[model samples]
Target chain A: MHPAPSVIIFTSFSGLGFGLLLFLGLGFPPVTGWVAFVFYAIAYALAVGGLLASAFHLGNPQRALKAFTQWKTSWLSREAWLSVMALLVMAVYAFCAVFLDTRLTVIGWIGAALSLLTVYSTSMIYGQLKTVPRWNQPLTPVHLLTLSIAGGALLAGQMTVAAALLALAAAVQVAHWQVGDGALKASGTNLATATGLGTPGSIRAFEPPHTGTNYLLKEFVHVVGRKHSRKLRMIALTLGYGLPVVLLIIPGAGHVLGLLAVISHVAGLVTSRWLFFAEAEHVVGLYYGKRSA
Target chain B: MTELPASTQKKLGLVIDLDTCVGCHACVISCKGWNTENYGAPLSDMDAYGADPSGTFLNRVHSYEITPAEGPAQLVHFPKSCLHCEDAPCVTVCPTGASYKRQEDGIVLVNESACIGCGLCAWACPYGARELDALEGVMKKCTLCVDRIYNENLPEEDRQPACVRTCPAGARHFGDLGDPDSDVSRLVAERGGMDLMPEQGTKPVNKYLPPRPKQDVSHDMDILAPFLEPVAEDPKGFLGWLDKALEKL
Candidate 1:
C-alpha cells in the first residue's frame, strides 16, 4: 500500500466531518441560527474537502462523475452515492435548522442515518479488498464506524457520550491492529501459491520482471519499518483516543481543554489513517517478492 | 454493468508452460511493443531513459528458484498477465463500469474512455495484472490482444495474442479452455496444469504447466575418473633419463 497522502487526508478528515454531521442531524447540541450555521459549514467543509482530496489521487479526475454508476457491485461506487445523498440531506436539514429555526425530527433522523451509512460505505471501499488481507475483516468497518461516531460526539460537545465512544474506539483500534498484524500470514498467500510452485520443496523469488520499477510495485509493495509503525501507533492511540477520553472526562474541563482534545484527536486520526494504508500488505506483493501476502 | 455474465461463451486464456520458458522475456517485450502501439493507450513510460524509470506493462515475466525435496534447485520462469477469471474481482470492483469481462469470449478488458483511473480495480486484482498508465491515466491490461486475436485485417496465422505469436519457445498457448477438446485444454490435461492462488477463489481461466522434475547427475562423475588416472605417472620414457640426471645432481 502506498499510504497516499490524498487518501489519508480524505479518510481521516471525512470520517470526522461526517461524524459531526451525524451528531448535528440527530439534534445533539440543538442550537439554531448562526451557531447551527457554523456547525454545518464546518461539517460540509470536512466532508467535501476530504472527498475532493480523494479525487486528487485519481489518474483521471475528469471522469469521476462516472464513478457513481456501478453501486450494485462496487463499494467505491456505493461510497460516492452514499456520500452525495448524505451531504445533500444534511444540507437541507442544516438549512432548516439555521433559517427556519425548526427541528424536523424525521428528516434529521434520516440525514443522521445516511451520514453514518456514508462512513460505512467508505470503510467498505478498503474493507472489501480481499487482495489486501489486512483490511479484509469485519473489524475494519467496526474501527472506522467507531472512530466516526466518537469523533462526532466530541464535536457535538456531548462529553459524557464522547468519552464512552472514545473508549470503545480505542478498543476497536487496538483490536484492528492486533488482527491486522498477522492477517497476511493467515491468508495463506505466499511465493509458492503465488507462482503455483509449492509442489517443490520451497520457492523464493529470484528475479523480478524488469530492472526498472512498475506501477504494481510502487503502489502495492510499500515497506513501512516495524519501529516507525509502532511509534505511530502509540501516537495515534494516545492523542486520538486516550487523550480525548481523559480530556472529556476530566472534572472542570472547559472550552480551551475541549479544543485541545479535538486538535489532539484529529492529529491522531491522521496518523492512524497513514498506518492504515502503509501497513496493508496486498497479496499482489507476493509476485514481486516484496512480502508474504 | 460491472456484474459478470452468468457464463462466458468461451473461456479464452493462455496456458503458459513453465518447463519451456527460458526467461528470455521475449513475450514481455513483444507484448509491450504491440500493446503500446495498438491498444487504447500507448502504455506510457515516465523517466524512461533516466533515473527511477517506471512504466505500465500488461504482461511480465518473473523468475523464481525452487529447491525440490530430493534434487538440486531449479529456476522457473513465470509469466503473468490477467487470468481473465470466471469470477474476475477486477471487473466487479470497477466503480465506473470501465472494467468488464466479455460475455462472448471471456476476455476481461477496461473501457479506457469510461475509466476514472481511480485504481480500485488494480487493488482488487491479486495478480497485479492491471496497471494504470501514468501519462494517459487510464487502466492498461492484457486484452489477450483482443485487437489482433479477432482482427480480420491480419493473416490467419497472425490472429493471436502478440505474446503468443512472438513466443519462440512455443511455451505460450492460447485457445478456448472452456472447450475440453481444445488444444490448450488437452495440453493442460497432459501437463497437470494448475492455477495460481486457487485459494483466492477467483477461478482463473489461465493455467500454468509446472516444470518437470529435474534429473540428478552427480553420480555420473565416476566415468571421468579413468582419464585422470596417472596419464603421466613416472614421466615419459625420454623424460625418465632426465629425471635420473636431475636426482644425481
Candidate 2:
C-alpha cells in the first residue's frame, strides 16, 4: 500500500510494452522498414525499462537474480521467469520479422502468448494478496488485461480496435472500482473480531502502541480522503480512458492523435495505479483499529 | 523450501492473557531490546530524535477501550506478534526461499543472508507481524527468540522469548502448544483461549485469553451518609482559615 514509484512504473509501462509486443507478434497492422524499427524500439524500451524498474523496488536489487528460481510457489518468481521468456521469444520473433523479412507465425504466436502471460503474472503478484481484500479478487486480473490490451492497440495504431478495447477497459475499470469500494467496506474483520473481543458492545482504540510511526504504520496504513479520491478517480477516468476514446473517434489518420491517445492513456493509468495502491486496505490495519483499512 | 511442512514436530508459540497484560508495554520493550542485538539485524530508526520518529519492532501492544452492554468500560492491552500459522502464506509467497517455517518447531523465520527483501512475505501476513529493517534493507520478524530458546549458555529458566521471560504481569506464556499437557496449552484450555481472526484461515498457533467478567462492585457496598462533620464549622484556628482560603482560591 506504500505505492512506491518504481512498482507503479514497472506495472504500467511493462504492461503497455507487452501489450504492444503481443500485437506485433500477431502481425497486426503489418509494417516494415523504419516504421517496424520504431515500433520495436518502443516495445523493447517499455518492456525492458519496466523490467529494470521493477528491480529498484527490491530492498537489495543486486539479489534479484535469485528471484527467478522460486517460480513453483511465488507469483513474483513466476512473473520474473515469464517476463524473461517472453522478452527472449519476442527478440527472436522481432529478428525474423524485421531482418529476415519473414513472419514465422508459429514463433510469433508463441511470443504473443508468452507476452500476455507475463502481464497476467504481474497482475497476480498483487491479485494473490489475500491480506488486501480490495485487490484479492477476480476483477484485478480483468482490469490489468483489458487496460494492457487497450494501451497496446493504441500504441500499434489500430484505431478501430483501440477504440473498442478502450471502451471495454474503461468499463472494467469502473466495475473494478465499484466492486473494490464495496469489498473493503464489507470486510469480515473489525476491531472486535481482530482482538477476539466480539462479546464487547464496541471496541475503540484507547491508545496507540507508540506515539511515533513504526514500519507497519509507514508501509501499510495509508489514509486517503474520500472527497480527494473521488476527484482523482474522475481525473483518471477522463485522462486514462475517456480521452483515448475521444481522440480515436475524431476520424483522423494523423499519427499525432494515436500518439496523443497512447500518452493520455498511460498518464491516466498512472493515476489509476496510484489509487489502486492507496485505496487497498490491508487486514493488519484492524490491529490498529483502522475502520476501513 | 517455503512450503510449510505437512506437520511440524512441535507447535511452539505464545499464549498471551489479555486480562492480565495491564498495557505496560514491558514485553514490547524487552522484545525490541533483546532482538535488536540477537538473531537478526538491529531494529533501526529513521529520524529517531526528530519531530516525527519511526522505527521497526518485532512486537507491539495495542490498547483498546471496550464498552460492554452491561458493564463499565475497560481498557484492554492487546500484544501481538507472529502467530507462526499452520498455513502461513508468508513463507509460500517468499520468492527467494528466505522466509520459512521451521519443521522442528512451528516458528516462522527469515534467512537474512538469502532475503532480497521484496516484502511480499510482509504483504502475505494478516497479523502485521513482519517488518523491514530500514538500515539493512531486509525483513525482520519475531523468531520466537530462536537463538535464546536453543542456546545452552542461557539458564534453563531463561531459555524462552525475551518478552515471555520479562513480562512483569506473567501475561505472556511460551511453550509447546501442540502438547495438550504443556503449561501454555493447559492454561489455554482452562481459560478458554481463542484465536484471532480465525476466518483468515491461517490457523494461528498462538491464542489469547479473554478478560474475565467485571464484578458488581456497587451491590457490595452501602451508600453511607457524609462521614466528616463539616470541618469544625469553618475554622477553629489559623491553619483551618488558611485551608478554607486556599480552597476558595
Candidate 3:
C-alpha cells in the first residue's frame, strides 16, 4: 500500500484546526482570533501543505479539484472539502471573532464541532482501511486526535494535561508498536508474508532485475539495517514511547518537555512508520524478487 | 447527500472460477475494449513494444501454481479484477467525489468528469483494482458492464457482460450476489465460496471457490534418509564374512 502522507497530514494538520476550535468552544479566555489566526494560519498552511504533499504523489496535480464532487460517500472528499471549509471557517471566525467579538459562543461551538469532525474524519479515513491492520482501529482516531490536540496545544504554548496526554500517548505508542511488531514477527516479520534472507531455506534466490534499486524498490519497497534491528526496535519502543510518558508526570517540565515529547514522538513515529513501511513486504515484492524468499 | 432509494436492489457481481480460467486475458482485453470506447479515453501505453509499455487496465489475471492440501500442485490461473467491495477503498480514498459506490446496484463507479486524477484511490486499494488511464487522463476501472447490463436495446439475456457471454469455458458468471436466492448466490452457497482477500474486510460480493481436485495424491520423498554405503568399500574385512554368513542364514 502507498504510504499516504495525506493520512499523515490529515492526522498532523487537522490537530491545529481541531485544537484551536476546542479551546475556543470551551469558553477558555478568548485569545484574540489574531492568535487563533496563528493556529488557523498553521492549520490551513499545513492543510495546503498536505494538499501539495499529496499533489506530489499524483501524475498530475492541476486536475486535483475534480475530486471534490463525491463527498456523499468518499472520506477523502469529505476530508479535503471539510479541511478547506475548516480553514475558511477559521478565517471567517478569525475576521469576525478577532475584529468584531470573541464572545460569539455559537460561532465558536460550530467552529469547534467542524474542527473535531475534520480530525475524526481524517482518522476514520485510514482507520477504515482494514487491509493495514496496524492503522485499522479506533486507536488510530484516538491516537491522531490526541496527537493533533497535543501538537496544537504545543504550538499554542498551552502546557496543560494535553501535554501530559501526549506523553502518555507517546508511551502507549511505543507499546503499541511492540504489540504490532510482535504480531508481525510471528507472522514472519512483515504485514504480508515471509520473514528474512539469512542462511538457508527450502526455496532459494533469483538474480535481481536491477543492480541498483528501482523506483518501486526505492520508494514503495525498502529494507532497513537488520544488524541492529532488534535493538533499534527496543530503543524505538523504549525511548520513543517511554521517555515522553515519564516526562509528562515531571513537574516544571510540561512546556519544554511537551515540546520535546512532541518532537520525540514525531521522530520516533517517523522511524516507527519507516519501520512499518520497511517491515511491510508488499505482495508485489515477492514477484519482483526484491523481498527475500 | 441525497438519500439512497430503499427499494429492494441487487449487488451484481462476477465469480470467475480459477479451476477453469485459462489465463487467456480475454476479460482484460474486453474490459479495456468496453471502457476505452465507452468511457472518455482508452487505456494508453507509454511505450508500446518499446522499453516500457505501461497502461491502465481494470482487470488483469495472474497465473499461480498452488499446491492443494490433498492434490497435486497445479497451476491455478487467477484473474484479478475489482472485487467491487461494499466498502471500496478506492471510493473512500478519493479526494474528489469522482469515486463512488452506487446505492441502487452497489456498483463501484468512477466519475471521470468529477475526478481530478489525484490517484489517492489507487494507493488506498490493496488489490490494485483501479488504474490511471494515460490516454484519458483519468482513473478507470471495471464498471461491471453497467452500460450494457442495463441497456434496454439488447435482449433480456444478451445485456450481460461481453466477457461472461464470450467466456468459452463458461467459467465466468454474472448475477446479483446480494440476493440470497439469485443463481450467483446459490452457486456461491452450495460451493462454499470465498472472497479473494477477505482479510481486507472490503466485503467483496465476488467469490472464489478454491479448486477441488479431480484426484488425490499422497507421497513424501525421503531425501534426508541415511545412505547405505557398499560394504566392499568399507574397511571392515570381517564384514564380508559376516555378510556371507547373514546371506546364508
Candidate 4:
C-alpha cells in the first residue's frame, strides 16, 4: 500500500463532503437563502474536489469516463455512478432550498440516501480487496460509514448528534485498528503458501528478482515502522475523534470552538487515511519477501 | 462485462517445473523482449539507465532457499505470471471492462484501448502479475502470448508462449488444463502440481511442479579413496635398486 496522496485527499474530503450533503439533504440545518447557498457550496467543493483528486491518481485520467460502465461488478465503478448521482441530486435539492425556499421531502430523502450510498461505495472499493487483508472486513465499511455520518453531523451543527456520532466513530476506528493489526497474519498466507513450498522445513527469500524496484514492490510493499504508526494512531484518535467529541459536548462551546473542532477533525481524518493505505499489508508482498502476507 | 463467464471453454495455462529452473532468468528476458514488441503497448522503462530504473514486466523469476527437514538447503527459482484463474479477481475488479478472461481460451487479457489505468486490477491480483506501463499508462500482463500461440504466421513448433518457447531447461509446459487428458493435465496428475495460494480460492489454471527430493552427496567421497592408494608398497627391479642406492648415498 503506497499511501498515495491523491487517494488520501480523495477519501478524506469526499467522505466529509458527502457526509455534509447527507445532513443538508435531510434539512438538518433548515436554513434558507444565502446561508443554505454557503452550505451547498462547501458541500459541492469538498465532494467534487475530492472526486477530481481521485482522478489525479489514475494513469490515464482521460479514459475515466469509461469507469462508469462496470458497476455491475466493480465497486470503483459503483462509486463513480453513486457519487455523480448523489452530487446531481443534491444540487437540485440545494437549488430548491437556497433559491426556491422549498423543501421537497421526497427528493431530499432520496438525495440523502444517495449521498450515504456514495460513501459506502467508496469504502467498498477498499473493503472488497481480499489482497489487502486489513481492509477486507465488515469493520471497514462500518468505520467509513460512521466517520462520514459523524463528520456530516458535525458540519450540520447538530451538536448533540455530532457528539454521539463522533464517540461512535472513535469506537469503530479503534476496533478497526485492533482487528486490522493482525489481519495479514490471520489471513494464513505466508511465504510457504505463497510459493507452494511448504514441504521443506522452512523457506527464506534467497534472492530477489531484480535489484531495482518494480511497480509491485513500490505499490504494495510499503513498510511503516511500528513505533511511528503507534504514535500516529494516538495523534489521529486525539484530533479526529477525541477533540471533536469534547468540543461538541462542551456546555458553552461557540462558533469559534466549532470551527476549531472541524479543523481538528479534518486533520485527523487525513492522518488516519494516510495510515489506512500505509499500514495495509497486501498479500502480494509475500512474493517479494517484503512481509508475511 | 467485468463479470466472468460461467466457465471458459479451455483452461490454457503454463505448468512450471520448479525442479528444473536454473534461475537464469532467460524466460523473463525472452518474455520482455517478445511482449514489448508484439503486445498492445511496448513495456516501457522509466530512467532505464539512470539511478532509479523501473519498468513493467509481465513475467518475473524469484529465487528462494528452502531447508528440508533432514537434508541440506535447496534453492528454487520461482517464475510467476498471471495464473489465468477460473475466478480471476483482476477481471471482476476492473472498473472499465478492459480486463477480461476469454470465454474461448481462458486467457485473461487487458483491452489496453479501453483501460483507464486505475490500477485496481493490479491491486486485486495476489500474485503481482499485472503491471501498469509507466509510459503508456495501460495495464500489461501475460497474454500467454496470445498472438504467437494462435498465430498462423508462426511455425507450428513456434506456436506457443515466448517464455515456453525460450525456456532451455524444458521446465515450462503449455497446453489446455481444462482437458483432463491433455499432456499438461497428465503431467500435473503425475507430479502433483500444486496451485499457488489455493486458499485465496481464485481456482488458478496454472500449476507448479514441486522440486523432487534431493540426495545428500557427502557420503560419495569415500568411493574415491582407492585412487589415492600407493601403486605399489615396495619398488621392483631398477626402481627398487635406485631407492636403496639413494638411501645409501
The numbered model that scores best in TM-score is 1
TM-score of every candidate relative to the true structure: 0.98, 0.94, 0.69, 0.96
TM-score of chain B of each: 0.95, 0.89, 0.80, 0.91
lDDT of 4 by residue, A107-185 (tens): 8989999999999999999999989999999999999999999999999999999999999999999999999998988
Per-residue alpha-carbon lDDT of candidate 4 for residues B29-145, written as tens digits (9 for 90 to 100):
999999999979899999999999989899999999888778777889999999999999999999999999999999999999999888999999999999988898899999999
Question: What is the per-residue lDDT of model 2 for residues A1-293, given as tens digits with 9 covering 90 to 100?
Answer: 78889989999999999999999989886756667778899999999999898888778877888887778899999999999999999888788777877778888889999999999999998899888889988999999999999999999888999899999999999999999887765667666778988442477778889898887887898888999999999989999999989999997657888778878898899999999998888888777777543
Cα deviation at A249, candidate 2, in Å, is 1.9
Docking class of 1: high
C-alpha DockQ of every model: 0.86, 0.71, 0.17, 0.81
| lDDT (C-alpha, whole model) for all candidates | 0.92, 0.88, 0.61, 0.93
Q: Is candidate 2 or candidate 4 better by lDDT?
A: 4
Q: After best superposition, candidate 1 residue B223: deviation in angstroms?
A: 3.6
Ranking by TM-score: 1, 4, 2, 3
Superposed Cα deviation of residue B120, candidate 2 (Å): 1.2
Alpha-carbon deviation at B115 in model 3, angstroms:
2.1
- CAPRI classification of candidate 4: high
Per-prediction fnat values? 0.90, 0.75, 0.28, 0.85
Q: Evaluate residue A66 in candidate 2 and report its C-alpha lDDT on the 0 to 100 scale.
A: 82
Worst 10 residues of 4 chain B by lDDT: B224-233
Task: Report the lDDT tens digits of candidate 3 across residue range B3-101.
Answer: 123432678889777668776777777777876677556767656677644666677665544443444555555666777777676766676666777
User: What DockQ does candidate 4 have relative to the true complex?
Assistant: 0.81
Ranking the candidates on lDDT from highest down gives 4, 1, 2, 3
